[model samples]
Target: MTIKKLVEQIEAKKSFLCVGLDVDLEKIPTHLLEEEDPMFAFNKAIIDSTHHLAVAYKPNTAFYEAYGLQGWRSLERTIEYLNERHPDIFTIADAKRGDIGNTSTRYAKAFFEDLQFDSVTVAPYMGKDSVEPFLAFENKITILLALTSNAGAFDFQTRSLEDQELYKQVLQTSLNWENAHNLMYVVGATKAEYLADIRAIVPDHFLLVPGVGAQGGDLEAVCRYGLNKQVGLLINSSRGIIYASQGRDFAEAAAASALSLRTQMQQILDAR
Candidate 1:
């Protein structure tokens, strides 16, 4: 999906919520484990229940990869199910993949071609060459890990080099690349104060913000500084939504959680 399409969906739905599918088999309801493919079964239920409330669904690859081949198959099936049933919903493979040169191309093809994800999170630590390969694909976005939501982010991202924080340098440098408009960023909502400065650097690009809800990042603060004319934000809520219940009505509980976020998002859009 193009960024235009993504923004359109955000407007049409009156939401900018991106539901994170960080499914842990151990944490999912035990009843789902009885299914032949528990991971996919759980994901299908979540998607079916919350599709109307979300503009995007991000499946964090580590959740599936942890189970080896069955996990990969489940991931593939889940992506296929979404594409077939809910093509309008933006899909993100939260693989955080980046490698040197040719290898990066293969990784790009695997997700953008084989699995057909609309975007993939990429680590820009390897510099431009490693990330540029993912940008070669049309309408497929490279969500560069900038200021992340984790505690580890301060170890390097906040370090000043050449009189600017390293992540700020990344935002500025990435804009100069070819097809850079196809790029979005992973900005932790926890760093809400920096959003205004980050916006000054790349005002138009969409920001895939994690750290809301369970992580306690304030949604109102994120919008106040991060939002642009196009509603340039995809606020994700994973555990807070997907794990809202551990009972047979898990999907309904998930939907309710998603609806709560969507309701807040609609209010934000209206205020804007």
Candidate 2:
């Protein structure tokens, strides 16, 4: 999906919520396991229940890869279902992948062409050559990992080089890459304080922010600094929404949790 369409969805729904479909078999309802594809079933229920409240759905690749071929198949079915059923809703393959030039192109093709995800998360550690391949695709976004939610982010992301943080440098340098306009960034909500500075650098690109719900990041603080003229933020809530209940009413419970967050987002937008 184009960024314009993404922004339109956010406006139409009054939400920028991105539901993270990081499904764990053990945590899902026991009854779903009876189905041939439990992961896809769980995802379908969640998406159906909360689709109206969210503008995006992100399925982290690790969850599918863990189960091997079956898991991979489940991921494929889930994306196909979304594309077929709700084409307007943005889809992301949260497969934080980046490698050498040729390898990165193949990875990009796998997610962008074969799977047909609208966007994929990428790592920037390998520099421009590794990431440019993914950015080369038209209408597909390459969401680069910037300041992350994990505690270990300080080990490298925040480190100083010539008195500037490494994450800032990544944001600055990435702008010069090929098709850089298609770039969005992953800025953890836990690092909300750094957002003002981040916005000053990019100013207009979208940010896929994780850590708002389960990770205890403040939504108000993130919005205060993260929101741009176009409302450029995709706040994700994974465990907090999807795992709201493991019982038979899991999908309903997920909808309730999503509604709570979406309502809060509406209030934030109204206040602005």
Candidate 3:
């Protein structure tokens, strides 16, 4: 989907909620274990229940990759199902891939061309050559990792490089690169205070924010500093929503959790 369409959907739904599908076999409802493809079954139910409440769906590739071929098939089917059923919904492959140019090109093709994801999370540590390949694709987005929500982020991202923090330099450097207009950023919600500075550098680009629920990132704090004129934020919640219950009513509970976030998002947008 085009970025314009994504913004439109967010506006129409009164939400910029992006539901993360970080499904783990051990965490999903036990009853789904009897199904032929438990992972897909769980995902299918989640999508059916919460699709209306969310503008985007992000599936962390590692979850499916861990299950081997069965897991991969589930992911493929899930993407195809979403594309066919809800083509308007923004899809992201949370793969965090970055490598040399040739390798990055193949990775880009694998996700954007083969699986047809609207965007993919990419590591920017490799610099322009690794990221440019992904940017070459028309209409597909390259969401570069900036300041992340993890504890380890302090080791590098926040460290002073020259006069500026490393992540701030990253945002400034990336903005000057070719095809940078298609770039979105991955700024963790846990680092909400840095967002005003981050936004000052790249005010118009959408930010795909993680760390909202399970990671203890405050929604209000993130919105307060990160929000832009276009509602340039996709606040994500994975465990808090998808694993809201471990019983047969898991999907219903998931929808409720998602609706709660969506409602807050609506208020944020209205207030803006």
Per-model TM-score, in order, reads 0.98, 0.98, 0.98
> Model 3: residues >4 Å from true position, as ranges?
214-217
With a 3 Å backbone cut-off (N, CA, C), the pairs that clash in candidate 3 are none
- lDDT tens string, model 3, 1-272? 78899999999999888989998999998999999999999999999999999999999999999999999999999999899999999999999999999999999999999999999999989999999999999899999999999999999999999889999999999988789978999999888888999999999999999988833348889999988888889998899989999899999999999898888888888998
Task: Give the worst 10-residue stretch by lDDT in candidate 1.
Answer: 210-219
C-alpha local distance difference test of each model? 0.93, 0.95, 0.92
Cα displacement (Å) at residue 207, model 3: 0.5
lDDT of 2 by residue, 4-121 (tens): 9999999999999999999999999999999999999999999999999999999999999999999999999999999999999999999999999999999999999999999999
lDDT of 1 by residue, 63-161 (tens): 989999999999999999999999999999999999998999999999999999999999989989998999999899999999998999999999999
| Residue 189 lDDT in candidate 2 | 91
lDDT-best of 1 and 2? 2
TM-score of 2: 0.98
